[model samples]
Target: MKLMTKLSMTTLVASCGLASAAVADVKVGLIFSLSGPGAVLGEEMRNGVELAYEQLGGKLGGVDAELIYEDDQRKPDIGKQAAEKLVRSEKVDFVIGPSFSNVMMAVHRPVVRAKTILISPNPAPAPLAGEDCNPYYFAVPYQNDQPAEAAGTYMNDHGIKKVYLLAPNYQAGRDVMEGFKRTYKGEVLGEVYTSLEQTDFSAELTAMKAASPEAVFAFYPGGLGIQFVKQYDQSGAKLSTPLYTVYTLFNGAANEAVGDAGLGVYASTPWTYNLDNPANTQFVAAYQEKYGTLPSAFAAMAYDSLRLIDGSIAAAGSADDLKAVRNAMTSAPFQSVRGDFEFNTNNHPIESMYLGQVEKDENGQYVLSNQATIVEHMPDAYAGECKM
Candidate 1:
């Protein structure tokens, strides 16, 4: 009689487990530069998240997934507030991003303390990859410096010397300039730091022109980039000195706004819309149809982040089991739009970086076209320094 009772209890437990598995919802938290100077990037990222959710039919691994999004406004303090809301109030299973490196740093501590998974769609700053490396943190995009390092090497090979350096007065922008200086053995005529929120670059451009550098390397992203490129063209400096970039030219709205002024400018990136891969082709087509515009690398990164999280949830077999889910995410081998990508020791992406030029596509739309594949299997600087 006792043995019979034990068998009945085991059967009841199994039935309950099955029922629970059938009705669980996966929650993902998304944060980005949703307003101010970096709003365009955030818009692209938000659109990508929406498109991915749409494509997934509101489900991941046969379970309904809910996405909770917040705007960081490119402010660290605001990012921390958003992270708190997502982790505690919303109780999301995973957090997606805070686009800018400064914002990422501000929010990383809180998320790590909560033992929640934070997948960075951007912000591969070096220190986070090394000394501050956390088990719960992962980056979907390549490091902030990798593309810039590749660009530096390309500039050196092209015989560009006496270059002018321009970047926002912030950590990420400074890191880009440092990466470029590490590789390019050129004479830097001047290194200028502008307010990250400032859209006007007239005085800086005038100063750079007076310095008479052979080329200009600018690290402005989003709207600041569009403004800089437009003003540069109007200054007629584009007619002589070559303008080199890292992240400024590839954003969707920025490209359209800058238009012909952006043509002939060179930039480096880890991924572009013109890559000749089946995955990228399908993604581009679907994205354009859904959003009515070309997708930026930021958008692609966000889409890939969702897919990565989804792959982990599927592998874990249950979203409720946090340990199992985290383990699955750590070892995930999900497909990305950028083709092959594997996590480095520091949880950053190990991938290819390309030096691309801005030009008009066959459809007469300005895009990151004529991408010249630069470094393949390029590693980030911080991974080697990390003991983990």
Candidate 2:
């Protein structure tokens, strides 16, 4: 592993040497929830970045890129601490993600104050794209609400009327619920916010059942999603109302844990293993070969984030010049596992979203299926509000 890493770093440095026509070392920092409830999501992201780094031979945009990875433990305070150390001490040229929204919010000020560019692979809480929109921050993935927006549209199209809403008590959870209601135009029987890492969802489920809504909409990611799906199924709710979700029950290790509980469930996303794009197919095959499992949406986003940064550095010819790098990244057009994507004015993606169904394959293994493109080059709510 050490030899592979050294070789990759050398290749990256060599590429950067060629691009700059001079030698330069570029530092990049990654902050993610590598432990706690969100560890699996962070691990997927870390794997994606690692794979990209290895494939690039340690060079991004023809520059020697040095990555410093730190775990946030899915806590806001810890993420802030990591951000401070990475920026003020280690002096990373660019930053990527805190995975969870609360952590991102905590890390944002220090990163922006340091004038370093933040390339968020996840954490699309509404504020960062709205009043807090910063010139240095960019998200390769769609905002947190985009998937929920698609779910709302699906419900609208299906003529569903009343629904109960459930999400964690946090910024991202609220963002998704609001986004869902924005498009559905249906009656929300009730809304419930559970503790951030709490495992028990029975009380919330009981309330949801009491409302007797036509459908149940939720936004639970990582381990919470797995627990919710299992409990929802065990509660016998599946026998009655359908569960409509955004990034809740889908593919990857999460789906594997969900098992038959997630079967027939519907969720919305911008990418899936079943997507018919050439890029997606290649990514899936390569990832499966390397890791012995298909890549998750988080993994795909991380891969794109690295490639995007590489493209930006290549375009600007210097990762050391963060302002130039940021500008290049903002305008860079790059290929992703999800196919073509470009940043909107808010530094968030204007990309496609799909409604996917969870089902078992012939092996009786759970997988994502029926990926239907619901929106393309979709605009976020904050688009009209952003001046840049």
Candidate 3:
């Protein structure tokens, strides 16, 4: 009788273990601007996450993953609705993105409240980095202000004293300008905040031309960037006044749309296609091969987010446990394509920002070539304010 009971107990235990492993499928909600002004950036980010999944063999830490994508349409209300659907209906274990900061701000609270792991591949707004920081939120990219700060510092060091600033009148726009002014030791000829949907920059260009600042700094991403660059080029601004900007302005993805118009522009970014590291080299080549275009900084961040999530799940040993995943993410176990990546107390990436110049590569393609390292292992300014 004892021997028969032991055999039955072992069989039950084996069956239970098999059931657990079989039901270990993870569901992830991916929200980003699939249409509207930010579509290009969103598409690139989507591709990055998709590629990462493929490379992982459709599994994260030995558990199969199902990714549900939602289009936010670059609207805050739409983003909020999408977040609700992902959390309430789908009950996703992890959430990634809403490409722009405005959309992120609209959706962050609900995700945090649900205690779901929310990892942003882009748009690390200032508030989330500071007092509003949440234990459930992690930003795999640099803070919204970091790139702008790098541009400002670069321009200041290069003796560009007077500059004109332009951005969309939004949270990120305001943050970018504030970041620039923080490091810029120059005269601000003027600052213009245009509507997010404003396609034509003729009025802004006229004003910038009139100001005749030594340099012009602008933060227009996706379609807006393409329009701005083409208009600035047509205005003959490239010949006399230089343009110094951040990502989405002078990278391979943007240059494909801006064409020769983006030539001679200087931009600051944490990752570039030309970064000389084995991980980056493999990523750039694989990305180009799969998508038939160069991966942008946006794409790089998305790729990193997936890898980070994968490592966290492995470390935690279970994707369903939010606390374990959060604790594992805080430790940052993955290697980033950017070479050196760590998370600060604010959950923002601590990485180097590089100066890149828009130039033609050997293949005659316009790409941002890495020129120099502008900042090294720079932690976000708001991190100190974060109690987490």
Candidate 4:
């Protein structure tokens, strides 16, 4: 948590009594799991947002911006408290992320209840997309299930008839299974929901191997996915049944730790660091130069989220008007790292999903290779149920 920022505080012109020259200040609250297993993901998000702020010259919408961060500790109640503190106490105009779906669910209430904009950089659960959708809520990332659905569609196109499913026991895990099922018409040989904190996968691996599925699909994230991939590699499951996963290939620590073990594994995501556009190229280079490491999908999405915020505020002429801000956001007035981005009717993203295989780069390090768009302009299934 040391050396958190590289930008200086903004100076206001009002000190000289120049009212016309005074610009509004925007407060952004980041509530992510900065402790426990998900800490790596949280750090990635912070780094991305920080990089965005720095790139924006420490200002948003030509106004001074302040970022307040809080640790949810990977707990529901803790995340809820953080949300309350950000909105009711700190009066943040925008609140972003609790990282995991469970934590996102907990924080959704208070942020929306207080009429603050709840824009998630990641972990857009189904509840927020469907009947429970709120005007104050918006998600920059694709719905939790879109990547899994794209993976399932890819498996079906490849004639993979049977597969085993594994995910952490949580709302997102369930969404992965449901999304995969929605597309893949093949039989599911086995399904396992591992505990969020469980690192060892010996028992689960044993059962999965016994099932002899054509391929294995898993939706583990953060440290949990790192351990699962390592154990799955050690179990030699990839020797026979290939592994298809979401968020494991190009995410921060998970990708680096499971490097070689992840070779030949398949992944689906909305964006990749190696996209062939100038925005992505610039972002990747700047992020690597600043952090001395490749940015993850978490970072990329977070980077886009703040850029969206900046563009929205500018389009609104300032951060003082919520209705104008919301309108500008829905218009999506930003050049995203993804190159192409827009918000759906439900305020979730309508984005293309790509499939990729893990392969060694020219430097002999593992990278997501052979990426291609599998699902174009994919929208969440729950969007229809959203009243707003």
Candidate 5:
């Protein structure tokens, strides 16, 4: 009986040792607007994550990774449902995305309550930057208002005393305009809030033209951006009053669609394809080679999100420990493609925002060339309000 017991104990110890040495599966859930107005941005983000996954050899934190993608359809309720499913049923270890601000706001509560690490590649709403901030939430991208604030500073520096503001009538739009107004010393000729999916901006453009502002700053993103830029060009508004914008106007996806119409426009962004960095060069080349298109800021953020995750997990030495992972994320162990990157107390990025001008390259392709640093190591205005 003693000999049998000793053999059984040896067998159990060997099995346990093998199990400890084996790699575990790390599951990640991605929620984005895969089939709605924001679909283009969503696709770019997906490409970015997938590219990072490939570069990492399909592993995260030295473990096999299983990625699950869910379509939010650009709807808040849909995003919330997707988050619920990912957390409760799919049991993802980490969650990334919910492309737009509205969707992010809806899904934030549930994801936080579940104690899952939620990293946003886009959609840094003002509320989350402030009083509603969550310890579990981390934004790899710039805060929603940072680019607008940069544009405001650039316009102010350029002596643009009068401007017109236009954006969709949503929380994000309002926050961006507020950010612009924060630093802009000039007079706002008029403020126009349009519906989220409104394709026809003729009336708004006509009104904006009549206002005779020195410049126009619009924040129409995705298809809305393409429509607004084309209509603004056809409306001859570009000739009279130059257009300055934030994420909505100048990006790889929008520039490709807008073509020459986007030329000579000024905008603000946290990252651009023209940035002269090794990581950016590699990322741009790989993305273009993989997708047959230039990568946008959306893609850059997505790529950064995965890189950040990998770094965080490595720093923490475990993907399953939520507290350790959060600490590692706050430490920001990875080298961001966008120069220097850091997180504020609110877990939002404190990074530089650049002034970019859309110009035609030698190949006659519209590219956003960095003009200057609009804001350096800028932190969000709401960071003080966040207790955690």
Candidate 6:
């Protein structure tokens, strides 16, 4: 709540015409994995929101904003608790949550059931984009399979036949490989699913090297990704074949952690810090200024999440009607840090996807150089399956 020392009620009401009655505080809850393996991503997601709130002059929906944070610890049950608390007790209008698909699948139903808008910065599971789509849920990032599909397209277009696939034996890990195979017209040299908790990949790396595929595509995010790159480089695999992913480049530290090992690695992404656009230019500058480091795709998408909400609030003139705000968001002019944005009928994003190669910048820092546009204005494949 903001204190108005000398301002009259009329002045307060006039300044923000979003409310018919006196404008009250807007509460937004955040649920992310603030502990365990995903802490870095969760921290960045929160950082993105904080930077967004600061840039927006500390107001949301034309009212003083109240942000409540809940740490999911990268677990589904904990995430469910966070969602219940935010909905049942805090009564927050919206929740920016779900860093991982496991947690997202766990908490999505309950939060949507309660009529609170649940916005996920990452992990737009294909299930939610199709038969299970919910109007109350909004995925700020591209659909989980979108980038993977783009990677598959890149390989197919470039005629990279005989590729090996690897990922953690989890929902998101499986989804990416599935998406890759969905578009890839290539020989599957081999397919490997590793344990989510597996730290060392000596066995898997040996197996991949034996297959001797033209290329390798793997989805081992978080610390696992960092480890995978380092191991792949050490296993003498990088000398023979290249590494590709849709996950590693999204995290800022992954580049630094892998360092020279990451060179020549290609990633498929929807947003990169290098995108040249008015919004992106401003965001990259502001984010670096505020965070004292380069922003990741996780941060970019979260920052865009609030910006879209701000635009929706302005168009709807109030957040009292949740559906109205959602309608305004979808139908309104979609400007994002990624240039243009649109939502499919299922509330998934319809946007351009790109292929980026890890290269050194002028400062000798590792950066994902935009290689080419893999897919433009690409709609998710499951859009047709969505009843909504």
Instruction: Name the candidate that leads on lDDT.
Output: 3
Q: What is the C-alpha lDDT of each candidate?
A: 0.82, 0.82, 0.86, 0.83, 0.85, 0.81
Q: 1-388, model 6: which lDDT tens digit per residue?
A: 0112113223433454433222446777788777788877877787787778777766776666656678888889989988998899988888888778888998998899998888888888889988999888888788888899999999999989899999998888888988898999999999999988887999988888888899999998887888889999998899989899984444576678789988989999998888999999998899889767778888888888877778888788887777888788775344688986788788888899999988888888777878889989998888899887
Worst 10 residues of 1 by lDDT: 1-10
What does the lDDT come to for candidate 3? Answer: 0.86
lDDT of 2: 0.82
Q: Estimate TM-scores for all models.
A: 0.91, 0.92, 0.93, 0.93, 0.93, 0.92
Taking the tens digit of each residue's C-alpha lDDT, what string does model 5 give over 1-388?
2233224323543543422213437777889787867888887887798788778766777766666788888999999999999999988889999788989999999999999989999889999999999999999998888888888888888999999999999878898999899989999999999999899999998889888999999988788889899999999988889998885557677788998788888889888888888889999899989888778888889999988888888899987786898898898998888977899999999998988889987777678888888878999889999998
Residues 62-162, candidate 3: write the lDDT tens digits: 78776678888888999999899989998888899889999999989989899888999989899999999999999998999999999989988899999
Residue 246 error for model 6, in Å?
0.6
Clashes of 1: 0
Over all chains combined, what TM-score does candidate 2 have?
Answer: 0.92
CA RMSD of all predictions: 9.1, 3.7, 8.8, 3.8, 8.9, 5.5
- Superposition error at 264 for model 3 (Å): 0.7
Residue 317 C-alpha lDDT in model 1: 91
Cα misplacement distance, residue 74 of candidate 4 (Å):
1.1
Candidate closer to the true structure by lDDT (higher is better), 1 or 2: 2
What are the per-residue Cα lDDT tens digits for candidate 4 across 1-388? 3113212112222232222213437888888777788888888998898789778865778777777788887899999988998898888899988788999999999999898988888898988899999878889878988889999999989999999999988999998889999999999998889888889999999999998999999988888888888899999998999999986445655677887888888899888778778989999999989888778889988898888889999999978898899888888899888776788888988888888777776766567764788978788899999988
Model 6 compared with the native: what TM-score?
0.92
Q: After superposing candidate 1 on the true structure, give the runs of residues whose Cα lies further than 4 Å from its correct spot.
A: 1-24
Candidate 5 clash figure, as a count? 0
lDDT of candidate 6 at residue 231, scale 0 to 100: 90
- The regions of model 3 sitting more than 4 angstroms off are 1-24
